[model samples]
Target: MYQFNFNFEEFLAEYWQKKPTIIKGGFKNFVDPISPDELAGLAMEDEVDSRYIAQHDDEWDVKHGPLTFDDVPEDHWSFIVQAANHWHEGAAQLITPFRQLPNWLMDDLMISYSTPGGGVGPHIDQYDVFITQGSGKRHWRVGPKREDYEEEFRHPALRQIKSFEPIIDDVLEPGDILYIPPGFPHDGYAIETSMSFSVGFRSPKKQELLSSFADHVIANEIGDVHYHNPDLPARQCSGAILDAERQGLENMLRSLLDHPQLMKDWMGEHLSNNRHELDLIAAEPQWENSEVREFLTQPEVLKRLNGLRAFYYPETPTVAYIHGERFTLPSECEQVIPLLCDHEEVTGEMLGEMIEHPAVIDFLTQLINQGYWYPAE
Candidate 1:
């Protein structure tokens, strides 16, 4: 387990989304979870989203992978693997410490391996990120959010700012963390061969939420009530959409959103949908509820699949959402929600007598058979 030396609460109150700051010795004596060679091998896989970025003579080049690393020059090149946590168990563990933040806002862990002098250039990102320095040293330059900052595309695939006068500039060694919020201009370059693990967070735009909610309303056949005003007042101007009539029309849509249960249903389903692939392997012989109950009584452990998004709203505790599907669990299985979503590993000691509940047993069996979780070997 990685030990964090700083206070997360203090960091959130002071720096989160407010400014960019460097937390030195964030992970004391931090050891990298994945190595460069292993990262390279993952980049060769077609399903993984990987990229190669290099700069030479002030010109930039970008390539989408499945890449053979042979053509990559010895220096001035970086290999970036997106959603590495989905594929690598070690990478998945990096997100455990950041659970202080809501998992709904949490994005995947992006691991980058850079050669000497390698970087993606100075640019601004729309999401917040906590970048942890891994094996070697990287020099980072971060500027405060600015309205006048101009972004230019260095390569056809890469859009970067012309430059920024960095307020926070330092050479980050292993175990150091740089926290940057959205729209801040920043850049980093490797001083030596290095790896950086970035824990990113994203918030959906208003447009996206409206669009998703609209889709949910349409799918469920919600708000079928049409406008029929029984007491119609005579309006001189027919072309004018009366304020009262407009308010009524607006209330039609608002009514659907006003219901706590309906909104919760939509929130649970939309938020639990995984944006990245999960590492799932179904059981060879699907186990029955009896078998799962028996296994839970043993001294073994079951682990949640990497990158699977599972969530439950506190208001509706009995309803658990996993990968866009809703499960209305029995109140007897209430304890199972945290076990299923909060924990990466569920041990017999943790489950205790709760596993014996028929509802809980059946739920676990369903999860195991579907490959959302499995016995730890």
Candidate 2:
């Protein structure tokens, strides 16, 4: 377990999404959970979204991977793997401490291996990130939040920005952490071969939320009430939609969202669905409920799949949204949903007590068979 040596509440109040700050020795005597070689292997997987950015002749280039080891240049290159937490258990542990943030907002653990002179160039991210140094050193520069920075593209694939006056210009060593809020221009280059674990918290854009909610409403056959004018007032101009008419139209849409149950359902389902793929391997031969119960009797650990987002709203205690699906949990097992949602590890003993209830046992069996939770190897 990694010890996060900063006061989270203080950080949230003082710096989160407000400014960029460096926390020196955030993880004392830090040891990298995943190595460069291991990260390279994951990048070679077809399912994994991996890319390398290289610079030559003052021009940058990018290549999407399933790349060979030979494809990675010795210097002036950086390899980045998105959602490494999903596939690598060790890498997943790095995100555990950041769980202090809301689970729904937590995105993924993006691991990167950079060679000397390696960097993606100065750019702004739309999401907040905590970049933790794992090994070696990196010179990081972060500029104050600015809206007018123009993008200067070195490569078609890389969206970099013109250089800005840096508010933070420092070299980070092992255990150091850099907290950067959204829209802050920042850049980092490895002084030596180094590893960085970035835990990102992304907020949904208004358009994205509206789009997703619309899809949910359509699929569920809700929010289909048509606009009606029971009392039609004669208008001076037929072409003009009256102010009352416009307000009514807006209210009609707002009313749908105002419905508490409807909003909760959409919020649970939509937020629970992660954009990235989870590392899931379904049980080869599906286990029966009896087999599931039998397995749970032992003191073995059952781990939730890494990067699997689960959420339960306090308003609807019995319902849980796990990976885009809602499970109306049994009343007897209401407490179980929070355990599953909030924690990475769930021991068999934890569920063993709840297994006496058939509904609970069946739910556990379904979860295990579906590969949401698996016995720890």
Candidate 3:
């Protein structure tokens, strides 16, 4: 039971939802999730989403990914990579430690390496991001949450500005962390050759939130309540029949939504679900379920998956939802769910404590049955 030595608990208590706070040199011996060469290598891949912003002479040039510096004019552009979290094992590891929340509530990390005068311009992201200054220096300008959000059609020649104004501006050295809440407009430019790791938490929008739930219902994983059509004949005319049907459908949906567990179900499925483009690195000859259980039973051995994160949406008092493998867990062991979620070191001591609860042990046993749980090398 190694608690985080960092003041995350104090931070969550004081300023999580309040104004943004800066932690001067918060990360100690913080290594860049990946090196510039590694990022460049990933950018050269055709499938990954990467971009570069060439901003000089008051003009901007932007290009999409699987690109190298040779792909663009190599003067003043900075490399911006998306879904870097998915491709790079280290970038993914950077975020796994923060799996206190559900996976659905979590999002991917983006990283960039920039030359002098390179920047993406002032932009507002739809989700939250924790920008870490990895190497060199970047000047970050931040603004407050603005009103009057403007949506443009994204003209090819025009610069798109999201709602953000510069309220705070400073130079970020290595290990300096900048936390930006959603809808806060901010911009960063490199003072020199700088690298930044953006750890983001992208919560769902209204449409996405609704669609995810709808998809889950259609999949028949949750909301077992049947949409019973009243077996009444067409006594009324066409107009009356349409109105009655609408009312019945609406009422049925409302009833399903009215359950106290509806939100929990949605959160669970969302958080515990796997990320896109999962790269499962297998080891040695495949072992059977029996071997998996035997491996898990070892007192000194620990079972952890490489490049995998497990998060639980622990909303209900009786059960929890784990991401990646997608399974239910005992609510009593909620205190330990994050250990698995972070994809960090998991100790036999922690498992022993959790297995003390018969239900939790049973659930983990089922995971072993599925070969999702593996012993650490």
Candidate 4:
């Protein structure tokens, strides 16, 4: 299943970011993560968010629903469901290979099924996503890019759909993939029954960027420079802060962003931190004096949780951050970081004679205590 084909990796390395490239027959032996019936069942459930849009001739009607297979009108229009990443483990498995991408960069998987003539119309996304064509055919119309987009008020809920004139139009077959970079306007219409797994990546908007920046301003004393107060009348009731105050505030803000550590910390938190659990364990380190060589060298195993992300943060110095919690390890333990980043099961024997390293033993103990990675008891 992990066979990396020459062409696939080549496409990723070369044309992934530069241009749009379609890979035909990428998922060999590609058993679907979820069957069409299973997905249809998910659509029927009340807790799941699902919607369908139909186009009869030129008229487009969209409706939100707890849609079942029966509610669908035999053909013609697109059905979209969101947050499959949160609900269906099977749907989520489609994205398992890309875990090499940090959770910060990787967003979520959204699988959509389109019947004949079904499409969401020409639309543009601000974030990068890979649309993996599954099961049937979908015709895609993609433009190089036209960012000066005009959006009109359609529904108060969704942001207005973008109008695009496609430069490239082609029908994608099963096991084909379409990579659409941010700002590219494209639309996909199903020629027959089709399923597409959209692997999306998160990008921060201006407001989110500003919020994190503001947080960095207050958390660290990067913005603590005092504002100069010129001598003024005691009864001054100026609504705004004076020139010196403004300059000081501007300088502080600049200093906040200018702080070398600001972007680094923000990136670490943004990328390494999971949207889910990151519980920090409070247990004290236990292997400092104990010669646990036997314990480490024995048939020991490290268990990996489903959503765990174990990354070594160089900035945090002697700490390995896993699932957003900081686990401090000894300085000599740096080599052990890769072992954790492997994100799969590893035994003491596979860890080899390096188990003699006190630092490695200590690191394993801390990991076990944190439950970020646990011993296979």
Candidate 5:
């Protein structure tokens, strides 16, 4: 287990989304959960999203992967694999300590391995990330938050920024963590063969939200009411939209919020949707209800599939959303909803409680059959 030492409330109040800071020895005696060779193996898989970046002098090159070990050079290159938690259990466990934040804000565990002098160029990210040094050492430089900066694209796949003055620069050893908020310019170069894990948090952009909400509205046949003004005064300027007309348009758009249930349901599904492909395999000859009950009765543990997004809304506490699907929790199972949302592993005792509730048992059986949760021996 990783040991963390920072005060959660203090960190959130003082530093989160405001600035960049380092927590030295955040995980004491931290042993890397995955090795460089293991990471390389993952990059070789076609379904995984990986990238190889190399820099020579001032010129940089990038190669999208499903790349084998032979394709990667010995040095001056970095291999990045996205959604490592989807494929690696150890990587998924890394998110346990970060549950202090809302589960809906969590993204994925991205792991990168770099050779000496290898680094992705300085760039700004729109989401918060906590980078934990896994093995070996990396030198990180983080600049202040800025919205205005010239972006440089040396290679087709790489988008970086020109040099900027750094406010935080230091060498990070294994177990060190660097928390960088959105809009900060930052860069990291491996001093040696090193592995680092980044746990990211999502912040949906306005345009993205608008686009998604529009799609939802159209798909659900919502907001179909046509505009009608019964008390219309004769307009002098027909082409120009009057203040009342503009306010009417605004009210028409804002009408979506009037249906709080629809909005809540849409937000729950949208937020719980996974951004990356999941590593899930449907159960072969799907388990029967009896078999599921038998397994639940045993001491075997139940583990949630990695990269599966699950959340419950405060407005409708009994309704849980998972991967764009909604499940109504029975009164008996409501108490355990947090366990299903926040935990990776559910113990036998928890399962025991859940199994007693027939609705919960049925739900678990359905999830297990669909491959969202599996029995862990």
Candidate 6:
């Protein structure tokens, strides 16, 4: 377990999305869980998403990876690997401490290793991120939220912005954490070889929501009602749509909200969908009831797959959404739903009482067989 030194409620009320702040020694005596070599190793895998960025004076270069060491130069370069938690167990463990936030909004863990003077140029992110220093030191400069700025594309794959006046500038050491809210421009350059882990939270854009909702409506064949105006009032111009006509159109779009369950279902499914490719392997020789029961008797650890999204809506209390699929839980297992959704790892002893319920056993078996959840070792 990681020991968090900051005040949770105070931080949420004061700084969450309001501004950027650095918490020194957030995890006291923090030891890095994953090494730089291991991070580089994962970046070489074809399924993993990785990027190599190098700076040569004013000219910047970026390359997508499944890259070997020979492809990356030793100096003036940085290697970034996305969804590290999905493929590395140590990186997945970092997500446990951030459960204070909503589980649905929690994104995957991204790890980056940088050589001296290596950094992604100044840029703005649309989501909240808590970046923790894993090893060595990094100098971070963060500017306030601003919409007016010049964006530069030195490399097609990299989008950077003109330098801005920084409100917070400091060097972060291992165990230190820096929280930057959405729209804040920031940059971090390593002073030496170092590793950093980022735990990010998702914030859906209005346009993205509109597109997704439109797709859902179209796929379900919803909103079939056509325009019906029984009492036609004469208009000065045929081209001009009157207030009544505009209101009717608006209401037609709003009709999708008339079914609360439909909205909840769509939101649940959308939010529970994985943002990155996952590393998964189906269980071999699926366990039978007896085998499952016997397995549950021993002390074993069950872990959720990295990058797997799982959430439950309060409106539909009995249903839990995992990887865009909904599972109905029995009343007996309803109490354990939070345990399943929030934690990355759960021990057999923790679930010992619930194992007797057939519904719970079946759900666990299905999850294991489908490769969503499995024994840690």
Highest TM-score model number: 2
Candidate 3, residue 107: the lDDT equals 63
lDDT digits (tens) for residues 76-164 of candidate 5: 88989999989988777788889889878888889999999999989899899999998999999999877788999787777799999
The runs of at least 3 residues in candidate 4 whose Cα sits more than 4 Å from the true structure, single-residue gaps closed, are: 2-9, 12-14, 41-70, 81-93, 99-103, 152-154, 160-163, 216-246, 261-263, 274-310, 314-317, 342-345, 350-377
Q: For model 1, give the 10-residue run with minimal summed lDDT.
A: 331-340
Q: Write the per-residue lDDT of candidate 3 for residues 157-274, one digit (tens) a residue.
A: 3345754557778899887888887777777888989899887787667897688878876776665665577676756565565666779878988866786666666656675565
- TM per candidate comes to 0.95, 0.96, 0.75, 0.73, 0.94, 0.93
Give me candidate 5's TM-score against the actual structure.
0.94
Question: Candidate 4 at residue 366, lDDT?
Answer: 61
Superposed on all Cα atoms, model 4 deviates from the true structure by an RMSD in Å of 5.5
Screening candidate 4 with a backbone cut-off below 3 angstroms (N, C-alpha, C), the clashing residue pairs are 77-118
Query: For candidate 1, what is the TM-score?
Result: 0.95
Residues 1-377 of candidate 4 have per-residue lDDT tens digits of 32223365666687655666566666664555777777777777776677777767756667776885555577786667665655665675676766655555676667788888888776778877878788888999887766587775554444545666677788887666788878777888899998888888777688877886677557654656565557654646668676766777787567666756556655555456555323334335544325345655667776665455566565455555565455556665555666666555677777776587766776676666655555556
lDDT of 4 at 280: 34
lDDT of 5: 0.86
Q: Rank the candidates by TM-score, best first.
A: 2, 1, 5, 6, 3, 4
Models ranked on lDDT = 1, 2, 6, 5, 3, 4
On residues 2-88, what C-alpha lDDT tens digit does candidate 6 reach at each position? 768889789899999999999999989888878988998999999999998899998898888896778566777899999998898
204 Cα displacement, candidate 4 (Å) = 3.0
Of 2 and 5, the candidate ranking higher by lDDT: 2
| Candidate 1 residue-wise lDDT, 1-377, digit = tens | 77689999999999999999999999999999998889999999988899999999789988898878877788999989999999998888888999889888988999999999999999899999999999999999999788888878779888788888899999999999999999999999999999999999998889988999999999999887899889789978989998889998898878887898888889889999887777777877999999998888899999988888899977667789998999977776677787778878898789788877888888888999999998988
Give RMSD (Å) of candidate 6 vs. truth. Answer: 2.0
Per-candidate Cα RMSD to the true structure, in Å, reads: 1.6, 1.5, 4.9, 5.5, 1.8, 2.0
The lDDT for every candidate, in the order shown, is 0.89, 0.89, 0.67, 0.67, 0.86, 0.86
Native RMSD of candidate 5 (Å): 1.8
Off by over 4 Å in 2: none
Give the residue spans of candidate 1 off by over 4 A. 233-238
